[model samples]
Target: MTRQVRRLAERTPPQRERYADLLRAVAITAVVIGHWLAIYVTRDGRGFQGGSILQVASWTRPLTWLFQVMPLFFLVGGFANAASLTSHLRRGGNAMGWVLGRTARLLRPTTMLLGGLAAAALTARGLGAEPALIGVAVWLASIPLWFLVAYVAVMVLTPPMYALHRRAGLAVPIILTVLVGGGDLARLVLNVPYAGQANFLLAWLAVHQLGFAWQDGRLPSRRSVALPMAAAGFAALVLLTVVGPYPVSMVGFGGERVRNTSPPTLALLALAVTQTGIALWMRGPGNRWLRRLGPWTVVVAINSMIMTLFLWHMTAVVIGVMLLYGTAVMPDAMPGSALWLLLRVPWLACLALVLALLVTLFGGFERRAGRWAASVGTVKGVWPTALTIAGVGAVLAGLLALALAGPGHHGPTGLPVRVLVAYFGGVAALGFVRRRYSRPARIAGR
Candidate 1:
């Protein structure tokens, strides 16, 4: 066995919470629908409905409020990072190496996805498809790429982030509140350049930091976590509606007056606080239920592929929509009346079926290979590690910006095809490097 694996074996088992897995499952399911619904263009092309059996389902939007917990996703990510990092530290594992290894795993599948999409786009373009259609396809395909960029930024900055967590203590929240409050002020006064986008790093990192706190047991006990979270969520909603310029929607759409995303506003930060609180509050009950659910080997098994699901769920939705398009059984126009919405139950069911099938087929990307276990490395210095992650992320972000930015971005023609192609290419290149550089010991450690 590799040294890292042996070390892991020698260590005591860390606290295992099935509820976290359950929460992750819930989060992934929500994201599936979020992405699916966001792209779900209605027939008149006026609003979102797929030109498929799912065309009748418009009732899904209300669920957005419930399921659009992207903040929660980060919250959980933070929690997991804390747990993993803590475990690694306890085991005398290299912190920097562990972080890089985890980050690398996250990026690998994403890279493969980008490459596949790029190849498909190139082949279609070679066949003389209109440039506009190609651009739209590529742009649509790249929608989930943002998560990768944001996630890497968070992971790469982990060393300093952890240090900040150690030093700031409760001051972290005060700083976050100030930053979020300032963001609100800026939105009211100065039109910041990609201000919301900028916060994809800062705002979410704060939530992730909360996860670290959870690991350290610094958060309040289970009894108290929920009420505070709910109150925080309520307060955030009030601020967003009354005081802040941000919109209510967690996911961006074309027509909103102002987006809650981009550079995340105070509202989103509030959402994160609230989400963290809720997750913590439910921990007691959630853990008990998850424990009874039995080994949760399946959920834990699925964890390996969580990134895969996130990356491909949208693609599955697109494919399902395409398959159902131009069929009379499927409505060209989405249901307008209440009765039509009621009839959409079956269509939504059908869409779900299609999504499941796709997941089964392509989800293997989530599984770690035997080779991965063999590739391990010693942890390096924090600054060097952070710089490596930052450098890579910066390169990707710059490339994406160049590709995705344009006039009439709302139109199909304006979708970012070239940038997406580059992204996939970059991912593939990274994966190649990983495979080449992977050590047996490191893989085992992971």
Candidate 2:
């Protein structure tokens, strides 16, 4: 591990933005830890059930403000995607190839996750495990896919979005913000059905657009931009939540009439703006600190398999629950009890150990898949780009469907056949795209 880290550090380009990698690593880490912390699992005489700490403790809802690091992902994603897409285009690459390259890293590991979950669910059912238990387990384990759905959608739109970014500059995010606000108004005030749903893309896109600005030097790491942006966003957040109708929690809580996160409202967008400011404010110092070999090495290590880490972290929790709680190896306590609070320490440690093992086993897939995708020659032509886009859309839809259905929603297989068909069909489409269009160069003297 030490040798691998050292080699990665040596190979890293000097001009690369170490801070973006650091932020990505930090965002995914926070998400993993936050999730592990939020989970509230209980075993009754009947069976095991899982829930969030936020359900029992209202105080923790505000803390979600700190843990809602997902915006950071889109923010960093925008920055990275802008850089990546631009470089690819500059080298005469087609949009289809660029999109394929971008999604390969995400989909490859996702395939592993879905396959593993399906197999596990089937095996559990064969052992006569209750379908309800399987459903909950599958649901909890597949939580990360929800984010992938949105992130993948945003990524597929990057080509046109980046082109718009080049043309419109800061106005893009501003317009998006206004659209998000309008969506919230229509939903909350007018009680318009499905109006808020649009913000799911608009709000995140607004945040992501900020990334393009940041990448191109339009959004600078200056107090002039950072302070006012932070203040306005913070002020808006307060007004939206306290003075207005929006929920205070940035994440969705059970039984909330209006969640800041679930379709996303102005409050969530405000949070994103504030976080963007904070990220910009810290960019200067953070990048300076990341210049050190030690910190950079740590960031590189975390990011190398970051997706795998995020995708499998919840599975680790499920495994720990079965091993420790299912068999009564670990005693249970009331959700917010003092004992439960104290028990969190050991619970976290156990989950971390299991997560580390899972990562060790699955992280290689991310790296290997990435290399294979990179090796495929870029395909050109309008049809290829259109088909690739369709392929990506199918994958996103399938993932969203599976996530909504839950792993065991259909029964013991842990996969709905139709949903799996859509997802795998998309994967197959991408595979077909690669083979049909990609032309590997002949070896010398062959």
Using lDDT as the measure, which candidate wins? 2
Off by over 4 Å in 2: 326-329, 406-408, 439-446
- lDDT of candidate 2 over 372-402, digit per residue (tens): 7655546777787677877887898898887
Per-candidate TM-scores read: 0.80, 0.95
Which 10 residues in a row give candidate 2 its minimum summed lDDT?
437-446
lDDT of 1 by residue, 303-347 (tens): 656777777766665566566644554555444455445434544
Q: What's the lDDT for residue 208 in model 1?
A: 73
Clashing pairs in 2: none
TM-score of 2: 0.95
User: Candidate 1 — which residues are off by over 4 angstroms?
Assistant: 1-14, 42-63, 126-128, 192-197, 242-244, 294-298, 339-347, 369-375, 379-391, 402-446
